[model samples]
Target: MTVIEIDGLSKNYGADKAVDGVCLRVEQGEIFGIAGPNGAGKTTVVECASGLRRRDGGNLRVLGLDPQNDRRRLLQRIGVQLQEASLPGAIKVGEALRMYASFYDKPADWRELMDEWGLTDKRRAGFASLSGGWKQRLFIALALVGNPEVVFLDELTTGLDPSARRTTWGLIRNMRERGVTIVMVTHFMDEAAALCDRIAIIDRGRVAAEGSPRELIAKGRADSLEDAFLVLTGGETA
Candidate 1:
């Protein structure tokens, strides 16, 4: 049950390749991760898969539909939380959620989502007034509002506090339990090792290495995922 498939996928920025002849597959209901250092093609590849960017070459399919050609259907069935998302500063938390919910034919309950994301007290707060963690939580809640079968999360915990990060991780696990597939892009090795079923380590516009956390670590002959990633990518650990 492959939910996503990429064959020799490539994306170019002017003359430079951002994603170069990459191939990967994500199974249905699995938590797949794309990990890499800065300047790597992780973002490019995920953006291509999400149909936000058109690929320069190769084939890509999401749930058996061509991502670029069948974008309308794909967009309806998949949720995306981009690395940098912007909302109107004057929009209240609840207003924002309701606006996003309107885009979907069937959406989750806004009230329940507010409480679950610990956003109840901040429901009336303006987007500008919310803390970094609260904003991140709201983004997560919005992404899930559509009850999408597959979700793309990029740097989801980037600005969250330690407790908030853990809380978001728990919510991600809950999404998995509900049979939702997740495609996550992150620089955090610990998050990848802990949550990902399979990880693709991309570097210099290509997949440098890929496997389960244990398999990757074993292949690198490293003690931990961080050490393995550093050894493989030749980059410093965060």
Candidate 2:
């Protein structure tokens, strides 16, 4: 099943083309990575696909629904973790989770999610008091609280330490096992290499390349995903 489809998608800021004529398909129950240097339109593509931004051209569908025209219905079936997210400074972790849970028709137990993400001990902690990694974990919990079929994780492990990053990666794999389709936007080559079943490298508002990490490396004649990324995006990998 194709969970997401985009063809000739375009978005612009003034005269600048942020995303231009990009096409891609994401299958069900797969981890799809969108990677590129900053301002390469990677985020713009997802923002458009998720209905956070309106596209200027082309067609897009999420679960066979037009994200722009069917936003309310589509939102119920998908969750998005933006590149940057925050809660009110005074909101406690548990409070935040509960609030997010209320948005969906059917929600997972926030308490269970807190325990699963190791946020149980920090339930009473204010959002402001939590460290970067803990905050990320909480955001992830919020994203999944709705029990969405498709989840967008953008820069999910950006500020986490190595240990926390690994733990989060494990959680992502577990999510895939449970049949959730994921569209991840990340700059971490190692993260993409380890987690993504397929990757699309966007550059200058276009898709520079798309393939598995190994295939990309082989095609680029590089030693690793990192080197392949560098080669594909013309030395820009963010």
Top-scoring candidate (lDDT): 2
lDDT tens digits by residue: candidate 1, 71-182: 9888888988888787989899999988888888888887889899999999999999888778888898888888799999999999888888888889889999999999
Cα miss at 9, model 1 (Å)? 1.2
lDDT of 1: 0.90
| lDDT string, candidate 2, 33-117, tens digits | 9999999998889899888889999999999999899999988989888887888999999999999999999998989998999
Q: Which candidate is the best by TM-score?
A: 2
For every candidate in turn, the CA RMSD to the true structure comes to 1.4, 1.5
